[model samples]
Target: MADTGEQFEASASAFGYLFQFAKALHICIEQWMSGDMAWNVAVEAADDIEIHQGAGDRRLIQLKQRAEGVRMTDLSEDLWKTLRIWAEAAKADRIVLAETRLFLLTTAEIPEGSAAFYLPPRGSQHRDEERALHLLREARKASKATKGPLPKCFEAFDNLDQGDRPLQSPLMSRIEILSGTPDINEVRNALQGLAAFAVGHEAAQAFLARLEGWFYNRVIEQMQTPGGRPVTGSEFDEMLSDLQRQFRYDSLPIDPDISDMSFDPSQAVDQQFVRQLGLIGVGSERIELAVRDYVRAFTQRSRWSGENLLRAGELGKYERKLVEEWRSRFAEMAEELGPEVTEEEKKKEARRIYRWVDLEARFPIRSGCDESFVTKGSYHMLADELKVGWHPDYSARLIALLEPARTR
Candidate 1:
């Protein structure tokens, strides 16, 4: 398995893309709302923006996206400090612009408990922080209005210098329709789990195997062209040796190491390699299919049929208690198995546990240990384990499983 550095790099890139996407989306929403042919919009902060409307008013908009629900703790104190400074500057700039406004836009409406503090801008610092305090009170009202219901849009605007027209018009319809930032936290958590598995035993081996397979494909691809310099047998051997040295798995017996744990071959194998080979009319697809079949057989064989009994509620209270005790013991055994276990075996165990946890977490059985189990393995092992029976075309299944759980 590879180290955390690669995974961290990948996640960072993904988050960066998400941030850019949010910024572009914010601009799109502004264009859509204002219907103005020309407007100056800038994403001034990660979760906030500054927009100068075509109508010639300076507006500051803050956007927040909370997937699991927003809380008071979700507001960063540093962000508040920054906002305080910005507000002061914005107020000062109002002297030049003749109109200035601030707006807070959120994906999910602010929760009632935290709503009091998110409203429009208040008076200058010298006056009662009443303007800021009033801003909070207005935010609380808005939050209450949108609770448990998704609003079409949300916006708050102020007129700093002009008494003739208020900032309310620009905000009323514009803010609610804007899409919140993409939820990067979800991907981060997923990557964290994957990284943990990479450090484990069986999963690590499987991951290495997948990586090796990927490298092998790259070599083969290079070899096939008419003028291409094919990889010599010695070169291939040397590359394998180098990989083994890098991963420190050359001394281990591949089969026993992977098999002993509960490696899900279907998950661990990189199907993309096989698919690419198939497109080239190569033999890799056949080999991959065979490997997948073997892995599936191994996983099915390792699963405890007894655990299915937990779903029925057929066991008496005493019997149920006994089962829980057995599960605890099994978990302990799994932990011990990690150190002495072959990498392959560790992978298998890790995959089975990871799949079980994933399924349980998504479905949430009322009374079961499925969600509580842990999978431990190296990066390769974890990836393979996570791949359990997952077809390359499993997106439909995932959507089917998740659709019911999503809030409208």
Candidate 2:
């Protein structure tokens, strides 16, 4: 029989670890947005998350997320374990006691008369640093003969307090117990609140999705590298600015998958867009470029349409604009050549017209849709449909070529 209960318990533990990461990310974003960019946040550094203010000053955070209604009592394991870690760090000289502020952020509530309850900020009604230090010392004494991890916890707690410049009072003074902290889901909601206003209601989800994706990728990279760089507030600001520009009313989000698509020129040799380029005496190199543009434009347009990013009839209007411009240029080229032009001269004129579309034409589907490939590839898309072509006699040549296929 399957042990479903054990499996679910293991899964829950995994989720707790994930929640720590999520909470750390949320805290970084919050601090950055609030203009506290001077500090650099590092995950799993001196603690679960460490915010460094330079000159050896730091804020170390330990996050404890528990089930609803759980309370941080005098003998709570979560309380003792957090104390042990901080005490060990102080004893090892890895942390400067005078320059460090410790934060214990938990989903659990702190009961009155508990060590944690008296360690809130001085402005808090329940705060009493002196009382907190006294309580911790008494608790350490009372647990002197306790077994399991309690003995080591007491030993570490004693080591920090026994030194010439006893760190107990200084450390207790700097510690802040932020009980009743928001859970993972609430933190996500807060992050959404921070982000949604920038992109508007309709596009808020997409904007946040992209932002979080970039953020998580950066986090992963940092985690893999030893002594990784801290994520700065300015970096977040810059990324937010970039995302804002992309999600603006005049701009459409460019799917990297479409724009960065790879293509094989050989594979598209039979494509009509390639044949159109050949009619204008385009070289293999230029034809290959044209094929690439065609694929990108095709894929991108399809993605935009499928995602409903385009307004109804907007693409049709843009295509009509391109075709109209091409028709005028083609007529002018035909008039210049007349009926007496040599084949070479006709091909030269056709290549000139093709160059104009590739180099000089500037038709954007939207004002901020400034990607050159989109315009270039869209022209190729028009050619592939036989609605626009460079060569004056391209229609005749294309019809003749397709007559065999039509017959079949």
lDDT tens digits, residues 212-258, model 1?
A: 35444543454355434433333434544443443332222133233
The regions of model 1 sitting more than 4 angstroms off are 1-17, 29-35, 45-47, 73-82, 91-98, 107-109, 113-408
Per-candidate TM equals 0.26, 0.80
Whose lDDT is greatest here?
2
| Worst window of 10 by summed lDDT in candidate 2 | 138-147
Q: What is the lDDT of residue 368 in candidate 2?
A: 85
List CA RMSD, all candidates: 24.5, 4.0
Whole-model lDDT, model 2: 0.82
lDDT of each: 0.38, 0.82
Best by TM-score: 2
